[model samples]
Target: MNWKGVLDFLKEKKFGLDRKELVEAETSPVVPDDFCAEEVVYEMNDMGEREAIERFVPPTRSTATRKPPARTKGHSRGSMVDPRTNRAITFASAHEWRCALILLASPEIAEVYDQPPAITYVDAEGKKVKHTPDYLAVSRSGKKCAIAVKPSRRVEKSGIVDTLDRIKPILGDYADDIILLTELQLTHERATNAESALQAHSCRVQADCDRVAVIMSGINGEVNAYDVAKAFGDFPRGMNAIWCLVYDGIVKLANPALMLADHPFVFRVLQATSVAA
Candidate 1:
């Protein structure tokens, strides 16, 4: 058949077109744009080039006045991320690291600066001496405390306790208070609890925290922590919130020595004999 006869046959077969439509489609074939074989011209501009670099300021390292001293034989040196500010806190010894953890765990403490600048003062013998505190802790209330941490054995031999006592008056010029912390103060329980508190503080589940807050709000006296945790339907999440409340001093653990889940606590009342370090 001829093209016209074929178009007529397609229409008769109901191929979705009439003879007039078929004729228009066959005549209106798509035509490509005329090709320009010459190489295309290009333009470039430096509008935003280096804009980010120009606006950038190299971040300042840290506000800490001095860095921790070099690691010597038999001495430990390291850094840990502070959960409060998410900054690294340097330490010269394991004791210092534990001290930092304890201080960071405290809600009262705003920041802990390691290796604060040396404090020079005259000892009782009238000789000038320099004492570099292990850590300088700033409380939320703006109180500055210079901390000297040492092992119980070293405290007496090093005479750090006496040294701090003698130079405390002079150090007062630098910090509001001079604290001497020995191994006696930094116990295993306190350090463990501090670590737990840090983890609890970092918990980001808002729903679990809100549920805990609701349970705590209704408590006027002591309550079983496990029961409160079970109320959340998810025991682990509920317990995390309870730990957060304890970490924040919103609750007082009765037997802090007990495991996190076993402790009974009073809401909104901070106890003198509490777990805080």
Candidate 2:
């Protein structure tokens, strides 16, 4: 064994020893403790800096100011299901409920919405104020209207009349018209009967309407309650169907002032020709 020759051969062969030493030297760099402390301070000062560089910074979703919701009148609120729209209509008081029923029954009315947009007006003190109307309605002729329900006494009291007078023109610009509907309009016995009739004869299907229309055409003119009921085979159903026609404008009552309880109630077909046409 030549020892000098053996050492030279091992060095020449390299034997993976030199490569392992080089890799260890490259991986383990000497880091200073003071430099590590300074890096920790930087990360503490700007915690989001790393996140900002590596990923997207989302926007802050916050409002500068908060507002409370508008308050409604403190009254005994009630709700009724409107047959025309089949929607639950809410009213602040009994007067409002009655007015809603009237609107539902009106042939002139096309649609009704509760708690319509707030109307802004300048008060008698020259201060700006907002008034939320009770009901907003569109007419058969495409006229927009705002209706305020109030008792007759309250209409004069609380300066309501004055306020409405001032707000009329303002509302008229946006609506076709604005009207104060007091108990005078809503509390009538005829109106009550009309509402009852509407409730009893709430018809939504075209088949019912077509059947009613045929009966009205056969009558060919104004007919008494008995005749109309008889034409439809005279039952609780026939009476309801007839009143439905009256409420829908397909038939017109001659004396709306008279209640349905009145004997020999008269009604004429308004849409007979139109239905034929």
Candidate 3:
């Protein structure tokens, strides 16, 4: 009944090694004096660090001037009221409009403004340049961002990258970051789904809050769209309510990478809020 001896014998026979060989193989290597931890260098009195910090930090001249770009006489322009901000947003191009729609439907975006201010910077040639970003956004996290929407073809020709780079230091004074978005990134199935969700935003009912809370509690964390629809007894109304909750940031799609059109859509409750609010 020596079970311990039996187990050790089996292990040694299976591995073809005794306890001495195992112990020797598991021993740690010795360290040399030359291999001691390098002394931590805290301060660098080099110009490299200074140059990098100066390049990234907002310039003092960023606040010296504020001027809007001259309006072109024949530029095609359109305007739409943002559902989230209730403000009339104007876009000079179709690309801009699509980008605006994407921003409007985003739950992360709290408020969006069109052409808030013109950023001024000096280019590589040392010429003073003024650039106006397409939109400025304030996120739910309170981070400020400036967005410029352009077609992929024009992104390089328009010097959008250089413009964003040169003006970033200046724009950093007002916004936490500057982003350049191409039409290719904004015009996608997700944008279409967001548009659909925005349309269903008005379907919220007073009882939706209680119903959603019950369904979420019942499922614990994740639930399929069909099951959620079944709980409400009316598929369209239930689906609309779910979309409304998503639009309001109450519930979030489990896989945002997948389009809402994907069958058996999965969702998770982000927060339980009174629909009456």
The candidate maximizing TM-score is 1
Candidate 2 residues lying further than 4 Å off, grouped into runs, are 1-76, 203-209, 272-277
Model 2: C-alpha RMSD to truth?
35.2
In the order shown, what is each candidate's alpha-carbon RMSD?
24.5, 35.2, 26.1
Candidate 2 lDDT, 1-277, residue by residue in tens = 4997676446534422233433443432223222221212223235456331233222232111222233466556666655545466677777777787778787777777788778889999999998777888887678998887888877767677787789887765568777888877787665676686566454333454467667767665556664555455433445566666667667766677656554335565544332110
What's model 1's TM-score? 0.68
TM-score, model 3 to reference: 0.66
Worst 10 residues of 1 by lDDT: 29-38
The parts of candidate 3 lying over 4 Å away from their true place are 1-77, 270-277
Per-residue CA lDDT of model 1 for 150-183, tens digit only, reads: 8888876887876788767776557898888877
Candidate closer to the true structure by lDDT (higher is better), 1 or 2 = 1
Compute each candidate's TM-score over C-alphas. Answer: 0.68, 0.64, 0.66
- Name the better of 1 and 2 by TM-score: 1
Full-model lDDT, candidate 3: 0.64
Give all candidates' CA lDDT scores: 0.66, 0.61, 0.64
